[model samples]
Target: MAHTPELSPSQPSGSLHRMTAPALQPTETGTGTRQTQLLARMLLTPAVALLFIWMIVPLALTIYFSLLRYNLLDSESAQFVGFENFRYFLTDPAFLASLQNTLVLVGSVLGLTILLGIPLALLLDQPVIGRNIVRLMVIAPFFVMPTVSALIWKNLLMHPVSGLFAWIAKLFGAPPIDWFNDIPLFAIILIVSWQWLPFATLILLTALQSLDEEQKEAAEMDGAGALSTFIYITLPHLARPITVVILIETIFLLTVFAEIFVTTGGGPGLQTTNIAFLIYSQALIQYDVGGASAGGLVAVVIANIVAFFLVRIVGRNLEA
Candidate 1:
């Protein structure tokens, strides 16, 4: 073979350069990493932008309308009113009643769901022949729309004459209680509780299943009874999930509108009117846009306050 020409000292051979140059590799890697980061940001931009617009636009408009003396029918009266709308909304005679009803409804539903859900969850978590079917049946109510559920309960179940509840009452020699007439708030609560019970049951059942078997075994070996084991081990395990359930339910319950609209129409003298229904009546029924916007803001603030307190409590529980 012909002797290879001597490589110049200033210029390294290709193989040598390729083998010895590690610095170039990092620059190329950095470029690729930067490109990946840029692409990731680009991909996320649209969703983030959409979310921001979706949340901010309505909030801004609500605030703007709340500050003006705007009525749907009277365009000439659309002038700045500062906090006057808020004063008017707050001073409305029905506001206090609505606020109280809203709180009672949310609190009662949470209590019932938690109390009933734990037992239901424990029952469902046990080994059964048709466990999947049972779970589906338990969770089926939550899938029903609020309007549809309200209608069913209002007509088929609590009709006070030919409804299922009335028939059951008659069979038991009890008078058929008119649910929406005599006890409108209770009727609303019952309807809402029925809808939410399934959600609570599902959440609690999932949490219950996540309990560590070894801990239970140890407790059993130490002569712990089922009740004691549940009080200690199971309840502690379910704390976080229960908090999550309560928080989520509270937020939605604060704004319950559809059921009241379909069933009571905030009627029987505003007995079943929560904050949401009150706002709806103001805006759509009364056509007082400014007052309704103010009420909506108030409801938002109340919800934020409740959520803040709940989050703080949950944080403490989580830390423990």
Candidate 2:
């Protein structure tokens, strides 16, 4: 072969030139990283800011107030009191009663809604006359304003003498029962369940609709009974939706205030006083800012605890 021409001095050796020619600049790499970080922050900024304003700010204020002997009525006379307010809330009989009532209300409502919702969902999903109208009627309660719903139920359905319950009792040749006095907590539970039942039913019905029809047919062909097919296939398919319903409903139910406020006002000797109403009473009625703040913190802690387990459980089920 003919001898190669001598390379120019300005040009590097072949391998060195290939390796060093126009490598990416450090400045460009740094700029790219900064751009990525900026994009991420830009995307997350709104949500993070909203969460801080909604949850963090109020929480910080509550914690600060809980540590002081502040009263809304006497704000100028607030004194540092460490955990006195917390101690008082934990020790007070009214607070204890309210806590118990809260548990009962939450438990009863959740149980009833789940018990009724699954069947209703199944039934609603079936081909039936007036299915669309029935579904609309079922979900209508959830859209009603909480206070409005409470007032309607209180005045139109439970108004002792003139309400539906009283009318039904009279039709049965029985004395009209005073719902507020004889069954305040149960009454609240019923109202809450009625509002939430549609939510659960809608969720489960959607879940049911998403199930594979072939699987059910195969199960039936394999001699599996209706209950067995439902238990093994349908229920398992509904696990995620059920968990979602439970989590969302739990959060809303824990903060149940308007219903109790309008319907019972935490009456019948504090039997209907859930934590939300208790906090309101402390801050607005009692004018005890510190005590209310302590109560608020407690409610937050309890809610977070429930939420944590719920998320974890739902996450695991989803993974499986």
Candidate 3:
């Protein structure tokens, strides 16, 4: 009789409320989720479309042009040539020289920047008078445009007869070296390194400041010398940043054209010609649009391969 007492309309049964509530919850949640997804897609559509227009369209046209025999110098319509353009570009002797020069430029710059950047970063991290001003002065080269930096170095710092380097050499009773003619690739590497060293130093200095002071202090207490402490503690902490620097520098290094274009002009033979300059030579100098298109695609492939490997290396370091 007690159990049979009628419940009030406002006081719903607990079991019925729990069952209905869960059922409504999933439905409401799913509807909200779908709306959020729709909104996200709508918001992303414009950027995705713009990206397609900018990047994909040019890439697609390059691919199409690679299959054609188009020449700026010729008045004839573009003719389909299959893969002959690619074959010709890959076999050109200039291409081989350019590839070699590219590798050497990239490797030497990476080495010099890493070797020099660490020390410079360490020095900047130390307590010094006018540290902010010194850091600003150090990073000033990075702000200089490639063309401008190339001109400055060519005219004011590396000129055999009148440059700053020449003046310094004369001060030391030595002849000024012909930077562009005798060692064009090395000169290119030096200019690029000068521009990028500040970037490396900035990143490394930030990493250094994050280092645990207690560890270094403890190492000092244990009689660990500066070299020993840096090698054992500091270097390992910097592995990730170094990898990041390598990845970023390699991407830009592969496409280094302005410095060579302004300074060396891929001149004194094919000594300083990298792949980017090679493409410019093919398209603008030779007027072979098809061959240049093929070269551009080849460069893209090469860059992708290098990027893939570097990304994998960086990923592994980060995970560790």
Q: Would you list the clashing residue pairs of candidate 2?
A: none
Better of 1 and 3 by TM-score: 1
> Order of candidates by lDDT, top first?
1, 3, 2
Whole-model Cα lDDT of every candidate shown, in order: 0.90, 0.87, 0.90
Q: Candidate 3 residues 1-320, lDDT tens each? A: 13333432334344444556665786765666667768888999999999889989999999998999999878397899899999998999998999999999989898998899999999998999999999999999999999999999899999999899989999999988999899888888999999999999999999999999999999999999999999999999999899889888999999999999999899899999999999999899989999999999999998998799787986675544
Q: Write the per-residue lDDT of candidate 1 for residues 16-101, one digit (tens) a residue.
A: 44554575685665665567768888999999999999989999999999999888999787999899999988988899999999
Candidate 2, poorest ten consecutive residues by summed lDDT: 1-10
The TM-score between candidate 2 and the true structure equals: 0.85
lDDT of 3 at 236: 99
lDDT of 2: 0.87
State in Å the error of residue 319, model 2: 8.3
**Per-residue accuracy of model 2 over 30-142 as CA lDDT, tens digit each:** 56556776898899999999988998788899999999998787779999999999999999998899889888888888888888999999898789899989989999998
Model 3, residue pairs in steric clash: none
Model 1 earns a TM-score of 0.88
Clash pairs, model 1 backbone: none
